[model samples]
Target: MPCPERHVIILGSTGSIGTQTIDIIERLNQRGYAFSVVGLAAGKNVERLAEQIKRYHPYAVCIGKETEGEILRQRFPKVRVFTGEKGLRELARLDEVDLIVNALVGAIGLPPTLDGLSLGRTVALANKESLVVGGELVTKFLSEYGGAILPIDSEHNAIFQCLRAGRLSEVRRVILTASGGPFLRVHKEELDRVRPEEALCHPNWAMGSRVTIDSATMVNKGFEVIEAHFLFHLPYERISIIIHPDSVIHSFVEYHDGSLLAELASPDMRIPIQYALTYPKRVETGLPRLDLEKISRMEFETLDHEHFPAFATVLKAAKQGGTSPAVINAADEVLVERFLEGGIPFTGIASGLQTILSRWESAEANLKEISSDAGNQDEVILSTLLAADRWARKAARYLSF
Candidate 1:
């Protein structure tokens, strides 16, 4: 019997994860696993998207700008082209698309994720914001629509694997390993003077600019903690983070019996990407294998909450359990962009998040008396989160560090 071809739509096709996912799909095809790219979506990287379209010949594609969509349509007249967030949703709901690889960054990724899951399509998710900002909505979709979410992030993917060692009832706690970014040794006081280039210099991973800076601030790790909570159905207290500079051990799950099951791999995003694509059946990735014998040292440290205050602030919003996470995510996105543009100091990222979150909390407290319930209507939840996101971005712009 021939292998069944799995149809896939990749959001963020020009991104680091999206390109790597394409590479994995090609490799899988060569290895007897049938996978086809049916749709691709990208934001502002038309040149790379064009190359991918030329190679893959996707059935449909989406771009951020309408002008660029016109260019793509003229270039590839046969391919259906769509633009902006609506395009993302259209590509996600494409008929016969077996999987939606959501590698999109920021809250923009959330709506398409909800769309894919609502249609009962499997989603290989790299966008942590989907869970961070809309975990409740995503959870509702999964329960009602009978879809699956395969985590593509290293830590959550690792925990997803380790959880198979025992049942969820048998689990005690899950430990997420962090690489401590490029500034583990830098003093807290010196962080305000740090440059964007310096902050983006990750020691273990090659990721997009936003993610690299989030890792430096350890905000990315906090996002993972929230992601794991939703993915594994574990409470926030049961999920933990630790600094492991080696990036060798991805994550760990501890059983009630005190046994710890860990997923270890060399620091490669493609490894988790492949696992997500091929899940339950490991295939040859041709990527470099982890050789534990060569360098025999692995160090672990407790996360310094004092040094990386942004992580704690994010967690605080996550604990608030409403639109707070959306606010934090949106504010961070704006603040990080400002930092990268040299408009704010490195420490401004954390300070700015603090200001926005504090304002959100105060506003929410005041509105609690008159706030009407929105119930669980998906559209209402989406609109509410989008409102919070817009408000945060606006607030972050006017914020002074």
Candidate 2:
């Protein structure tokens, strides 16, 4: 008997994880896996999107830039091309798509994620901000709508794999390992002097500029902690971060019985992406396998909270429920952009986030009034999150650090 086919849509089809997902799809199709892409969504990468369309022959496509969307519509007359975030949501809600590979960055990924989950489609989530901004809402949707969130982040994916070994109650702690980024050895005082290019040069993983920079400051790990809290249903205290410079052990779960289960790979994003897309079944990826004998040793260090203030800031926001996480995520995105564009120094990222959170805290009374009401409808809650996100971006942009 033939396996049932999965109809997929790559939401951020031009980015790193998106392209790698397409690669996995192509390879799996050749390996007797029943997988097909029915749609693709990209942001202003008409050429790359066109190439993807030509290869996969998806029925629908979307682009962020209206002119680029038009160009695609003209080029691929047979395929439907939707424009902007609306278009992205359109792709997500399509009845034919069985899975949504949400590889988009930032808060833009949140809406499409909600839409897909609401429509009972499993969302392969690579975007951390979706959980960071609205973990409560996303989880609620899962319970009500009967869909699953398969994490595509390597560390979270690792933890997911580890969790399978025992019952939820038997798991004591989940430890996420970080690559320590490119500036792991650099002194804290010298972080401000580091150039954007220097910070972007991650020692272990090749990723988008924003994520790479976040990893340098260990902010990405903090985001992962919050994500772990939501995905695994663990407390913030049980979710911990350790600096593992080797990048080999993606993550681990310590069981109540004093045993630790870990997942190790060769720092490849496709490994976890593949696992998320094709759950309960493992396929031959033809990638390099781990050879522990050749490797001498793996090192683990404590997270230097003092050096990476953004790490502490994210922890603080995650500890404070409601709209605080959304605010911090929005501010971090803006600060990362400013740093990348040479408008702010590397150290300015943490300082700016601290200042924004402080301002919001000072006006907590009014901000709480604007934050999501637990009893409200999902759409209303979503609106409140977006409102908070917008306010934080504006506050972070104009604030001096």
Candidate 3:
């Protein structure tokens, strides 16, 4: 049987990585490649999405917000657009989408990722929540159905690349490098003094709001650690984070024989996106090539858990296993949003999470307890997460006074 033309569905297309993926898609199309866009999704960037619709017309498009979807429908009557979680799932599981690029940020990206992989599609996952929230379940599903994940996140992408030449049994450890966000040098005592604008201004890579904040707390890297654990099928101890401010060398994998392989490149999202899109066959993505001469001093340091408590929280949760990590992820998402809203102090993110876990307790850990299917446990935990988030916000807001 002849292979179908390479069709891709890009979720969160209006965001940083999504926009770059579209740029790569346009380049691929211009070169008379078989790849075409099947689905596109964004939050509120209907105007640019309309431009995307006019250029490389997608078969399906989704807007997660209703007002945006309504506006988009009124504007582009010819295009088929969807809204909300159901629509996101439709776009994810579409048979036309040979591969799904999940660039959406936060926990919202979790459902579609689960749906995409569950349906046996190759998931190019940029979203960390899928692994952070549903790691065990996703792992079990992938094991059963045989779906492949092409890590679009640079750190995971690096580990994925390094492991290509070596076996897991021979692997000693996976060292995931981080940019250390904009606050690598900021003292822990001063974290509470940071404003939203300062936090948003990332020193290295340009990205969405939530992730930028996550980077500062080191929660983003922590999420990546849990993700690497599931993606590489290694224990939390085997997955480590190193602060590399240069962001040139993405990650490193050390073999049992003391040999460490590293993947180096400029902090370019297109490289990884293109790699997943073309996989095995390297495609030309009109992006600027990385120059080692231009980047002179690439340094690495140990992550300061004393300063960034969120990293320690995720690692501890990962050690607990089962529903604990999921709870940690969900609570953190809520707390971050609250902090962004001036509801909680910056340091309260870890505090809120710690409170939730302390209440959930170690002996109480179970996947079914946190899942939406289990009667009131889901509602209880979710409500508690939101409540804790609200409490954190209150604490943060009061702290301002």
Candidate 4:
């Protein structure tokens, strides 16, 4: 009798979480954890991906663009190289992979996620957009397909660990902790004047630009609120967000029995990434442990929805349920990119979502009907969501002016 090595396929293999996952796997292998890299996928970072393939020696590699795939195919002739969205789907459904680490950003992460789960593979999910855009569809698919999703986001991962202390029924409230980004203290007038460089300078965590900008607007936390609602089967009332500038207490879950449980660790992405890979069984990663005494004090502030209007928009979208979240998520994504490109002012991010949402409601009230009428058929639901997403992105771009 011997332990089997877990074969992993990492989507977005060149991004922040994907790179950290690779680092953890290498670290864990040194500590005698049996794991293998069977496949790797990235967007357009062929050079870094090529470096990864040489080091890890995966059997399959896929890129978003066919041109990059051709280059990779020539370089690694012995390895299987795939191209485009179809290739990413093919990579997820590969027969050899046991775990699919979907660290891919944006709504594009949704399809391969559904593919992996349909095949009954463990999905280590770092893509919050998957849940944010298609939470109902994802839950329905999981109910039918019988796979597992381990949260790789620090906040959700912490809440997941905290919820284990008590029965789900006994949980009263789950509090999500935010670092408040870099503008926690900026006055309202100054917010509109903040530049992309200032927004990208997150106070606590290092992440991709899209996510960093989302953090500045508190929309990242808003999406987390929706994510928690679906992941834990908790109502919006039970989910709360607080500004924890220290970034030590990742999240907290309060029980009905007057007990609160929290998960605290250094704001290291690798910790959650490693935990998601080897869940129900912790392994040594050789990272620094949390030093409690060195932490002088922890402060928590109530989220000022007025300051970050994106939070209010997320709350409204989550409550509305049908295609509302998809519209808002798409709008937010476009606006974040526009802000980064200096095409819009900082305040335009929130205003863009509001305008797009209003226009969507006016143009296609039936979209919500379609979403709500789709029932449990995953295909129909997903199609409706995709249509809504496309419409929102187009509308948001128009509203950006």
Q: Which prediction has the highest lDDT against the true structure?
A: 1
Local accuracy of candidate 4 as per-residue lDDT tens digits, 197-226 = 999999888999899999999889989999
Best by TM-score: 1
Query: How many steric clashes does model 4 contain?
Result: 0
Clashing pairs in 4: none
lDDT of 3: 0.79
1-401: candidate 3 lDDT, tens digit per residue:
43348888899888988998887877766766677787898877878888887777787799978888888788778777899977888889887568899998766677788778778889988988878877776787698778888999988888888999899999999999988888888887898888878888888888888888888888888889899999998987798788889988989999999999999877888888887777877766567788878876778888777888888877888887756676677677667787888777788877776776676574353432444453454344443333333443343333331
Count clashing residue pairs in model 2: 0
- Going through the candidates in the order shown, the clash numbers are 0, 0, 4, 0
- Span of 10 residues, lowest total lDDT, candidate 1: 364-373
Q: How well does candidate 3 score on lDDT at residue 332?
A: 72
The lDDT per prediction is 0.92, 0.89, 0.79, 0.90
User: Per-residue lDDT for 163 in model 1?
Assistant: 85
Sort all candidates by TM-score, best to worst.
Answer: 1, 2, 4, 3
| Candidates' RMSD to native | 1.8, 1.8, 4.0, 2.0
Q: Residue 267 of model 3: what lDDT?
A: 86
TM-score, one value per model: 0.97, 0.96, 0.88, 0.96
Model with the higher TM-score, candidate 1 or 2: 1
C-alpha lDDT (0 to 100) for residue 77 of candidate 4: 96
